[model samples]
Target: MPAGKGEKQPYFHCKKLNSMMKNPKPYFLLCAALIVVSFPTWSLSKTATHLDLVKLKNGTVLEGHIVSQTARSLNLENVGGMISILRESIDRVITAEPGESAMFLGAQLLERKKFARAEFFLKIAAEYPAWRTESNASLQKLNTIKEQLEEQRREKEKSDIEKLIRRKGVEAGISELERRHSAEDDYWGSVRGRLHLLMARERLDHYDLKMAEQHLTLAEKYGVTKEQWESVRNEIVAMRRKSLLYGEDKLASRAFQSRKRPDKTAAGGGLLALAGEAKKKGEKVPPLEWLELVDRYAGENDVDPLLIWALIDTESSWRSQVVSPKGAQGLMQLMPLTAKDLEVDNPFDPEENIRGGIRYLRFLLKMFKDTDTALAAYYVGPGRVERYNGIPPAGREYVQKVRTREAALNKRFGLSPQGRTLSKS
Candidate 1:
């Protein structure tokens, strides 16, 4: 298509004067360059360039002009070149009238606080000399906003962690801390370092020398200065000497007992209670063959294992071969479609089902950013949750049941919502 009205004409046009090249191309190029130099900023504001978008099913999106189309394929032309795309591969297409500047569109989207889309447009604008400075400035501002949002999210997580610690005790805090601070990701290392130091001090105060030393070592690795924790380390050494001299005292043994007692058959209060009550009624509780798989994938995906446990219990009652009335299968009860999407060939296999189900849970958690809503999505479907902007009415009971089970598991394991008994002291 020719340039829009009031826009500069292309320096080269085909199908004219026996070839449209009767005039020298270099002369036309010079003329085009002069026109570009003389182009006014005010004229750019008047002409807001529009582009077409072809979004593919595999998440590749092409931004360009659809130059031509046939029944099975369409051709797109962009700065890159003309390319053909099969209709079968296309997910959706969006077309806009050709006329706006990328900078203008970026600024408009930025005003709407649509950061991701705005960043795309701003990046395009930044490539041109005329718009580079302004576009780069906008990009910087967008980055600042993203950083601020991240900081706010971290703050909210900290607040939630504090509340969980208050309600469930230090073990809960440790579990949450481990869930959020992985050694591979050091963004939260310093914060974790300080917390570990604090926990180590508490352990020392309680005369739990082993856990205290463990926390101290973790704190050092996480960025705590040796000097900052030297005194704590010294105390740990002194306590160790005392223990060696006197042998494992009753108080020390009691501290160990305090941590170990929660793992006892009778004291395993959470999900075990469910199994116990079922046994009391002569109802058979399914074997928990997938528990180890759940732990593995949950850690890999940074999901709360207790949540996965609750979901599995609610989905299939720990029966590896169970099939739901709706045709969902296995311990995690994966539907055939979901199983396929997760690349699980055998959904009834305990390991496959648990891995796929936990991964799905992780995806939902990231998409919805709330456990309850994500659980609702997990039960009903993400589309329904998104349509309702939260947990749908049909999924309320399912979410509630899973949450209740999660809390019970928390009690049973004596850990936080994210299950793990690191540092007993």
Candidate 2:
């Protein structure tokens, strides 16, 4: 017995171990062995529409247009042929549900890179996770690009930002500057204005009146938005007048208090009573914060708080990020162009949107020289108003709705005792 060969413990492994007795290939085989542990693996998926596919662990998706199927392979047609998968690669096979045949068919078209055909698919995709996320993410990326461009300009080309400020703000002979800028051109003038105003504010904040004055002059050279220019001019005038007369602007602030507020007259009445009940249960718009922003913005812009309330009600039902069917978006339901005109970076901010809308309301009133006509212009459009020379039917409807809502809001706020009347302005 040459030292019982099976009695010894196994030797350590090498790529190719060789013992004195002979080759120890069995030892190396043990070293080559790898224990693979896979975590619970499953794929999230969408059912196949003719060409729609789901990738499996093997990196191949079970694919084919189901003309007819057999026990082994599908009667698939790619570039003119039938194909087969060994079923091992398929986690499972799924087809679109019965009622969703057309929708799935559309998705199939999209997956095939049929851009035109994809449109129909996308419509269905709106409700589908795959399409919704893809579209929204794509859009969000584009918006981010725009914001980044602005940020870059803000840093590298301060002068551009300067132009934006001058075209929109005033710190000195700003009114005159604005008039000249307006007279110069009309395109992107508002942008130049905000830059000017921005520059002036920065300078003024740093106690650089000379720099501030220069910005105001540039702003006038470019054109500030009428509102911004007016505000700045008023400030400058007030400052100058105050220095000479030693008078204060006299600013005061106050808050509202919550109470058992309910409208007692109608089914919706008894806000005071409701407030009392709410106080007992702790649910109410605190009187201290009670539409204070609405009041302030309205007062400052010489707009009706009730009107803002009405706008909010119609636009979002108080929802901040609501986007409308007509593509009007955010709390105030501002159209893209309108929001841009207002220089609103974010419309979901209630205060920002409200101020912008009310400010525009003021601007429109000035343009039409009549409040009712201006409001009509707002609901329909300036173009339509100019074309029609009066309120359009749509505008009239909107105006009535807004007016009714405003009246209700006025009653709620205790601002108007007799509700509203559509008296001609």
Candidate 3:
């Protein structure tokens, strides 16, 4: 009674479709599962082969292409660069397992100086072991490029550096320039070093031989190498001889005319006065909490007491309780790993922290040459900071602030009845 298609039998297509519509859940679930299973493989296959890495738990990572792949060790293109982390030493790969790969591609891109591109690839490469070696290479290379870029910025910035010279003072200029040498940039101090050389030159220009000798001595103390130092010394000696023989009064005014100090409390100098003034306010130098403890610890290590004092002031404002967002701690703000390496029983203790901080400073000095470079290290974790080619924002502020305090110490001691250390007769 109900079927009336000219009294025809039920349609087979309608029957099959009606049956499917009755329970479509299985079909829907199967389609979704296929997508879920296939998506990652598609994503992986989509990667273009350029830079790749094989990660190993052993101290080494491999950088090259995946010439072949299995769950186990993959073939790497080249194995040697200067560092020991080179490829010849990769004894094992993921325990020689099968059907496995981890490639850090983005890191590899960075090595090629494709930062924007590397940034994209590296983000993905982080997901695979093959990319780790490349990723690390990329990071190291990227940092190197960043520094190169920063240095390129400075050559055009000579006038800016010169303007800063008046504000940064002798110490600031020294600090800034020395940092460049240590960072492998070698440009920051070039101009100032020239100025210092000019001091010797001006002395020779005039016949005031004695004053020139003193100024030359100061220049050498600022970090010129023995070659540069001896050269300056010889020039000074030669000029004195010439002046004595040829004439005196002609250039006399030139030698006698020394450059005047600019404003006392400008640039980095303002901070320098603060440390001393803090004492006047009844807040002890290095703070009573840190001063005694620093001496006890620093003296034990044969480290310079003043250098430790300077580092702490720069690192954490002498606050034993301070902590950086990066988890650096104490008056000296040692990163936890560094604290462990230095064997500080308690990183927060003023004595131990200063001791470790000073040791670290000494290490940095040997690593980079002079207090200025060391100060940069303490402020931003050593020569790595030079990757930015100059003082980073934090490092710049830290250095100025510390130098200001050190300057205050110099002033206080200079005026004190005790006076500074005396030269041997």
Candidate 4:
């Protein structure tokens, strides 16, 4: 029907369609049909100022002027003329608002594969209804890809660790693993367990049963398998049995029992008081089974008990049965000849070793008249100290370790360098 004066024309009616339908020539009906199917294009002003950005669910962004809209669809006029878009396929609609233009910037960054910056802007733009769905979907997809890449990197690192262990040694593998995981606070439990197992095995090879057992406990806590735990445990038990069978544990146990005890008054009440106060303050006194034995012999030989404790800790880490590769045995690492000259019947005996080591250190202290020089003489020999007229180059590190350990022990026991108990400030 044609509209009368002041009456509005229906949106579907067009003059071009009417002309073609009325002519009725060959192809006239077909031409009219084409016009009817595509007659809803509004003659909107083709300018950037009047455009809306339509973002599709599939991440396609279309810039055009919205010609008309119905309840379920909208008509857009771009360079391609009229496109009818279903409302369900559209993710968002950005009108020609000034700030809404930045929503498309995230899409551009995403196209360039700059995911971090893309996510940042996308998150900001997602605050509005115009860009929420697309932004969140993009973030989810980006996170998935990032997680995949991180997994690949971790897998590659694990492969490298295996290669390093095979080519070099377990120590090399442990160094590499520790270097990588040092920055991570919460690493995967399985990987941490593997690291602990490696350390346990290494310590076992070195015959450090105490450290090996400690690492094994940590390994099991982290997630090591029962089989691996059993294997390390058996090794530790075997090593301990070997030490006992050689009379190493027996002689040490007997010597410790036979050692003389120091009188609290003779050794100075301050030292005993410091230990008691440290215990009351919930501090761990340095772990030495023969601490009073050390004090008794050190007092007899005119040596500092703390210095003796430091030497024992550094030389053998408190393992009474440990023997060095150089044939130095016991907590003090006394060589066979040194043990003989000092009249130590069994170098593995803790009491004899401690007394002999304290006597030898006292002689060195009197001869060298310097604590560091005496420590250096103890590590390398009095002959080496005499040849160099001071601590040798190799013995400097030994001297430093002993002195550092002595200082730590002093702090631990609340003692000062002048043999007086230090008061807490």
Alpha-carbon local distance difference test for all models: 0.67, 0.52, 0.55, 0.66
Model 4 regions lying over 4 Å from their true place: 1-269, 272-289, 418-425
The C-alpha TM-scores of every prediction are: 0.35, 0.35, 0.32, 0.35
The lowest-lDDT stretch of 10 consecutive residues in candidate 3 is 416-425
Model 4 backbone overlap count: 0
Model 3 ranges off by over 4 Å: 1-283, 286-289, 300-303, 386-394, 415-425
> Which candidate order results from sorting by lDDT in descending order?
1, 4, 3, 2
Per-residue lDDT tens digits for candidate 4, residues 220-305, read 75566778877876676555554444444564455457555343442234564666566778876644346756776876665777
TM-score of 3: 0.32
Per-residue C-alpha lDDT of model 3 across residues 1-425, encoded as one tens digit per residue: 45766775543448766565678788779889999998875654433343445565665565553434333223443322111122333455432211122233344445565454454345445555444454555566677888899888877566655766899776777676665456432322332233345556555655556656555555554445667766766675455444444455745655446433222222233323444456788876656545655545554434555556666666687788899986889988887856764557899887778777766665565546566666776666643555655456767777777778767766654433122211111
| Cα misplacement distance, residue 55 of candidate 4 (Å) | 99
**Residue 215 in candidate 1 has what lDDT?**
68
Better of 2 and 3 by TM-score: 2
RMSD of 3: 24.1
